[model samples]
Structure formats: C-alpha cells, structure tokens
Target: MLLVKKKGQGVKYGYQFLRMRYIIMADILFEDIFGVKDIDFGGKKFLRVSRIFCESESFKMELLLDVNTQIYPMELGDKFRLKICTTLREDGKPDTGEFNQHDAGPSRADQFEYVMYGQVYRIEGDESSATDTASTLSAYVSFGGLLMRLKGDANNLHGFKVDSNVYLLMKKLAF
Candidate 1:
C-alpha cells in the first residue's frame, strides 16, 4: 500500500519490493477535499500570513495550515482539494530531490492554482485525536515554515514518512 509506480509493461518486482508496487488507485500519498471552516482563528496574525483551518470531506481529517495570503489568497468559503505527493512528474518519475526552478518539462503543479514543496518532518499518534474513527495519527509538513498538520486515520496517511520530500498541490473547487 505505499506508492511506488514503476514503468515497463507486464513486469513485476520481487516480494521484497511489494511495498513499492504500482499504485493504480492511489496515485499520491495523501488527498482530501477540504472546506474552509474558519480563517484567522484566535486572531493569530503576522505580516502577509493567515492561518486557515479546514476539515476534510471524506476522511474527516483536519488541517491547520499557514499560507502566505499575499501569494495565494484564500477566502472564508474556499473549498479545495489538497494533495501531498512524492513527485510532481505527471509520468510518476521521482523528483531529482534538488531545487531547480528552471527544470525543463511539464509538471503536475501546472494544473493547480497553488503549490508548495515541503517535507514530512514528523508523525505522531493520538488515541483521542479522532472523534469519528478509532484510528488516530497525524502528519506534519512544513513548506518553508508554512506548516501543515493533517490529522485523521492512519490508513489515510499510509505513504507518509519522516524526511520524505513532498509536493503540496491545491486547487479550488467550484460549486
């Protein structure tokens, strides 16, 4: 159940590589449709900074994120699909793990209105964290100090691991 998409028709890896199989259904590490519940909670403020709290549509996960509103403005009623993935390559190739602003080629980030590159720095479990489900887990990511906390079930956070390079892609949903 981890994402490890490999190319080559009619090919398979050894049992030792089962953890890195072709992820047909789940292309990315984590995905959730989040509805903005509140903005500027506690009046926490800094120049060009706004903290937005959101709740997931399907997994019931909660996200408290700090985004630079100057670059990517979000409204009080904004609903978006937030995705955390290992690679931005549409072909599923892993990222070079280097920062190359002029990297040639089309990326998955092109379709999204907002994107950020970050890493999963921590993960913890809290038995009482989730009210709806029995499972409890949380993944913390930082996009250059703009932090994100995703808390919900462990199954929803399957592929996430510490030090994993990730891309946060967001696209607004129109009703």
Candidate 2:
C-alpha cells in the first residue's frame, strides 16, 4: 500500500485512503557501532558513519538503513522492535495517477510524522572501507523483521549504539 498526501491533508477521510507503501515489522539486535567526527554538509553538522547495514543470518539477507536523524541512542547486544513506514512520495499524490480530493482529509501533524520502535540488532565497522579520523568508512547491523534507512552525518548517530531500545521518529518535509 502507498500513502500520497498533499500539503494540508489529514485522516478525516479514513485509513483506506492513507496506506503505507512499505512497512517493515521486525525485532533487531545491535552488533556494532562507529562514528566520524564533526563536519559540515549543506550547512548542517554530520558525522562519519552515516549508514546502518543490517543482515539476517537465518534469512540470509541484508538491509541498509540510511538515517538523517542526529543524536541517536542504540548499542551492541540491545534488542527492540523495528517499524518502518514509507510512502510512495512525500506528497499524497501519485506521479501518474489522478488524485481524488475526497480521499484526502485534513492535514494533520500525524500525517507528516513517522514513528518506529525497535532494538539494536547488531553494529559492526565496515572493513571494506578505510576509516579516517575525520569520518567513519562503514558499519554493519542486523535485526529480525524491520529496518529503517536514513541520510545524515556520523556524529548525528553518536552515542546511538549505547541504548537497549530506541524510538525512531521521522517527518516528511517535502511537499
């Protein structure tokens, strides 16, 4: 299912109109963590390690989380629930389909906010990439069912792999 909401729309209509294109529900464990220090990107502060690579040994698969959130709390050996929600686009409208105004409801804050609960499955430094003091090269992680991908700097995720469980909050700012 996919949710396409225009600016200033909400759930007054119903859930049938607001569906998630992708939602990953699973339990995860943190295996490793890495960080690169202060730098500027697009006028914003960022760290070295910016991506979370996850794998499921039993499933024989891996997923990557590119997060943009700053200052996260997660750590090795920690466990938690993971929820991932993705819409077709930041706006409620489809690129090729006709949009129905009736299907759109009031524009509420909840419509723009995304929240997920999960644990740190695993975190490992990326060995393929060289680590520099200015930044991290790469890292790896794993969980049972869910994962999230964001984009930001490594410092933004500093001290993230320290907590047992974490709540991931995101908001779509595009129109």
Candidate 3:
C-alpha cells in the first residue's frame, strides 16, 4: 500500500490528508510515460534506423533508443507508454524466449502495438553520483542490434539485470 496524499481533499488545517491506495503487483518490470525529446537518425550509418532521445513523464528517466524506422516509426513529440517485462503471457508465466505464434492463448502483447524481445547486456551505477551509492543506474539492452539505454534511479530499475531477457512493449499515448 502506498500512502499518498489525496488530491483535493485535505485536513482541518492546510495539510492534505493522507490516503491509502493499494498497488497491484504484476509482471511489469518497469513502466513509464515518455516523451520523445529529439531524434537522431543515424543517417547512412544505419539506414532505416533512428536514435530517439526520450525523457520520462513522472520519473524523469532518460532514454536513448534506436528503433527500426522501416518497421516502427516514431516522430518528434510522440508520447508513449513503455513497459519492460519478462513475459508476454497473460498468466504471468515466464516466456520461453522463443519466437512463437500468438495463436496459443491471450497474451499481454495482445494489447500492445509494438513489442520487441531483448536481453540486458549491461547495468552500471553512475560513478559521478558515487556519494549516493544507488543514486542512478543505466541498463542497456539490444533487440537484434536495435539498442536501448535506460538511465534512472536504481530503486525504480530494480528488476533489471544483466543477461536477463525482457520484452519491450510500447503504445502511443493519445493526447
């Protein structure tokens, strides 16, 4: 349960009343609302690929992601919900890490328009923030060379691990 100050309802004084709201635990490893800050199309170096810079809406995380523009295109100012997960199975079971037909059953991927399977290759703490041991960390993953670097607080990125397989799900937010 998260003790969050209820919005618009407060105590007798000027303080906001603390309200209890339960968070349901699920297979979501990490989720965030991100806005595309800028895009660097690795022109000629990687045709049909764009290196997009994004910043989180709430957590303020920074992301440098390379996407295959030929398959999934993202333009400037595009806001999307990104979720990294361990499985696409609806039952929360571990994925076999194999490309399988989606006809077996309903999947978490069913609700997502874009999905990619990737493996975490690196995770490191920010040496600049050495005073605060777990201040910030970066996780790098690769989906067949399309790379992603997620940098944020260690607490918010606890579930990530080097060599762990993960699925990236994304859906554009309609604003």
Candidate 4:
C-alpha cells in the first residue's frame, strides 16, 4: 500500500475526516457478462460480468453500467476493458486499490504505449445484441488517443469515448 506522511495539523484533520486513497496495478482480462436483470441505480440496469485478470483473488466481479452516461460505464463483463498499475501489499496479496486523487501522475503513454483493436462480440441485457459472421465486431483504436472506433453491421455501428488518462496504462499492455 502507498502512504503519504502528514506534514501539519490540517493534514491530520483531513485524514481523520477523509479516507486514505491508493492505486493498484494489475492485469485485467475480459471473460463474459451474460446475465443482466435490472438497473437499480435509475440508469441502464445491472449486469453480471466475468473477469479473469482482476487483481482480486475472487476472480469474478460485477459492475453496474449506466448506459445513459457514456463517461464511465461499469465493466459489463469480458466486454469492458481494464487499465491498471502495480503496487505491493503487506500480506503479499496484490494491492488492487482504486485510482485515487493522491495517485495522480504522468500518463501511461509516457511510460509505455500500445494499441488495442477488437470487435465487440456481444452486449448482454436488453440494451443491445451482437451481429455479423464472426458474431464479433472489429474496432481499431489507440490507447492514448481521443476517439475509439467500433465497426460491425451498419445497424450495430457505435463508438465509445474513452478517458485516455484513466485507461491508457491497461490499454498499452497485452491481456
């Protein structure tokens, strides 16, 4: 875990009221997200996603995707990708903490860079469906660029705006 020493009383006060923040670097692999039921959060309903490269030993986790807001949609399954960094834990378990404010630094491209281009095969739930011969869609996009493209059936064509700063690291590394 990463820690910052307090320099003054204000720092101590902040720690007492605010939570300590940290970031975790690890590999993330998309597995699947098949079952989707409801959207309890007043958005695009809830979906179950299967992940293999998660830092957590549990192996699988679910995220709530707000289809309405394209800014940061929860990992719907193997469909969504991950961008991570590395840090050590006291017990030896991988420290996979959320990227917090204190963790801000240079862009991942500055350290490493790459591009990921793949077809979005499926989008489980009532939202959308997969199309085409491979039943897969092809997309070519740069990790540190502004727009990522998704190509498939004209009916299924779409684009997702990525926050390069947040996903740049994981996008560069191969799964």
TM-score of every candidate relative to the true structure: 0.80, 0.30, 0.80, 0.20
Instruction: Find the 10 residues in a row with the least total lDDT in model 4.
Output: 49-58
Candidate lDDT values, in order: 0.84, 0.35, 0.83, 0.30
The pairs that clash in candidate 4 are 25-85, 25-86, 38-46, 39-45, 119-137
By lDDT, the better pick of 3 and 4 is 3
Evaluate residue 108 in candidate 3 and report its C-alpha lDDT on the 0 to 100 scale: 74
What is the number of residue pairs that collide in model 3?
0
Tens-digit per-residue lDDT, 1-175, candidate 3: 3243456774333222222111113457789999999899444357798899999989999999988889889999999999898888776666665656765688878888889898999999899998976599999999989899999998888989899888999888999
lDDT of 4 at 79: 36
Q: Give the number of the best model, judged by lDDT.
A: 1
Clashes of each: 0, 41, 0, 5
Q: Which stretch of 10 consecutive residues in model 2 shows the poorest summed lDDT?
A: 22-31
Clashes, model 2: 41
Query: If ranked by lDDT, best first, what sequence of candidates would result?
Result: 1, 3, 2, 4
| TM-score winner, 1 or 2 | 1
TM-score of candidate 1 against the unseen true structure: 0.80
User: For candidate 1, lDDT tens digit of each residue in 43-151?
Assistant: 9668898999999999899999998899988898899998888888776667776758777578889889899988899999996655655677889999999999998
